[model samples]
Target: MYGAITAVKDLALTVRQGEFLTILGPSGSGKTTALMLLAGFISPSEGDILIGGRSVAAVPSYRRDQGIVFQSYALFPHLTVRRNLEFPLEMRGIKASERANRVDRILKRVHLKDFGGRMPSQLSGGQQQRVALARALIADPPVLLLDEPLGALDRNLREQMQGEIKSLHKEFGITTVCVTHDQEEALTLSDRIVVMRGGVIEQVDTPEALYDRPATLFAANFLGEANLLEETGSDVQAERSRPFGMVAIIRPERLRISTRGAPRSPDADQRQSVIGMVTDTVYAGAQRKYHVQAGTRMLTVREHVASGQQVYSPGDQVRLEWLRSDVRFVTP
Candidate 1:
């Protein structure tokens, strides 16, 4: 329990065979600690870790038969790419000829066949990341652990690496557990996401379910932008009643903005509308975000940028509407 503080208490998680699961949380949420415990880098005080139905809580990190990639890439600065990839095989007492063949095949698989003679310092950031991943998988470990694997890359490189990681995971069919605070990364790469808070699991579900129907207010806001309807000081209209101590929430993209008193959707009977003055408008490349002040609450609305679409500016009165069925009740 780390003296007086408990980091990741009563944690029980199961990762299916060949499934990609991500542990997502912000700082101080115990995601890293949980990963460490799984990796055998640290022992849990109260629970055992099972891999393939066998307890490994007392196993050392190196003997756990798992591959790990850290945020720093962890490639030896003085070693050539080929040597770095061969290190894992050598540690397993493999013959020199076989290690060379495995190294060549893996380097070619990662599209770095010609860069084997180069040192870590000579390669670009993306190239170094590839080397790290290749080294981890060269041993054919059944499970893989990634600790903020893309945190060191820039935006464009990170996106590229995400695609690469996804492709490799599909090809290898290895069970993987990733720890990251990046919401977009979790949503893009995970088959299921485990949301953590205060050293406990907040929710666990598929990415779509977690985003579409978060059970808690913390999860709703963490996954994406949420509009709290009750704070508008107006009655909220929904298809179902909200439970006690719960609030109604709608995603920003669910709200449609139009000119005041404009034509409504075909199913007008099932929709609700609200009028508000535009407080701010943001133009992202592919979409636009609008902040509107309706009564006492500021609501956000997002829309894709399309041709012939009406635009709203600050101080402009706009009508925001959404289907009553789109509203979801969540715990605060």
Candidate 2:
């Protein structure tokens, strides 16, 4: 067990070598604890952790042979970029010639080849972050662990660095485990995402599966915005009564809105359409979000608010309809 809190249940996840697995959860969800435990910073109280098929629960931090990066960058302010990249090599007693060559190569790879002489304060936030990543990769550890590495940068820089990190992972082919709270970041970078809640595993699958078929109510709500609706009492069955709870989860994008009196198709099922009055419309780039009030329920619909499209305002009566396939049954 890596930094996972023992009093709270910890999930045992097996990450294959050279795969990019992301531990994703909200704050205090044990994602960071799991990363810490895997990095050998903290010991598991009960169970053991295995790396490369060997039990590594007794391994000390310095002997774990894993490189770690944190949100704060943790770059040494007093050291020049070259020195910062060289520090880990120096600690390992790598030859000066090899150290210089590796630093030069990584500096170029991270696009900081010309800034080797600059101090941390002299570089931009993004540049300083790249230096930190370069330093982490300089040692070439077998496994790489990251705890919200791009959380500090602005939106644009964060997106740019996410690409850089993905590219770097491909170039190195090292097994990586990242901890992040950002859904899009996890979706974009991870080969598989392990979603956690209350220090236990909620679901572990590719980003697409976790998003489209969340196993639990918490997993459904945590991954993205979801509209949860209770099924009518008549729809309940004996076998699914306790586990399924007659609830359905629908993503915002799965709904479509039609004005009152619009003709319904012959195949349109009444169960999939809800009568609602437009309560709000938010103009988001690429798509607009419409909040519709259907009786006591509020349904959100995402539609492209393109030129020549019919725009509905507040108080307009509309029907929010979706396909039955879009409705995912969540575990109660």
Clashes of each: 0, 2
Q: Tens-digit lDDT track for model 1 on 1-332?
A: 78899998889888999999999999999999999998998898987888999999999999998999999999989899999999999999999999999999999999999999999999999999999999999999999999999999999999999999999999999999999999999999999999999999999999999999999989999999899997574699999888999999999999999988798889989999888999999999899999999888899999999999988999998888999999999999
- Taking all chains together, each candidate's TM-score versus the true structure is 0.98, 0.92
What RMSD does each model have against the real structure? 1.0, 3.1
What is the TM-score (0 to 1) of candidate 1?
A: 0.98
Model 2 vs. true fold: TM: 0.92
True-structure lDDT of candidate 2: 0.84
The model with the greatest lDDT is 1
Choose the strongest candidate by TM-score. 1
| Per-model lDDT | 0.94, 0.84
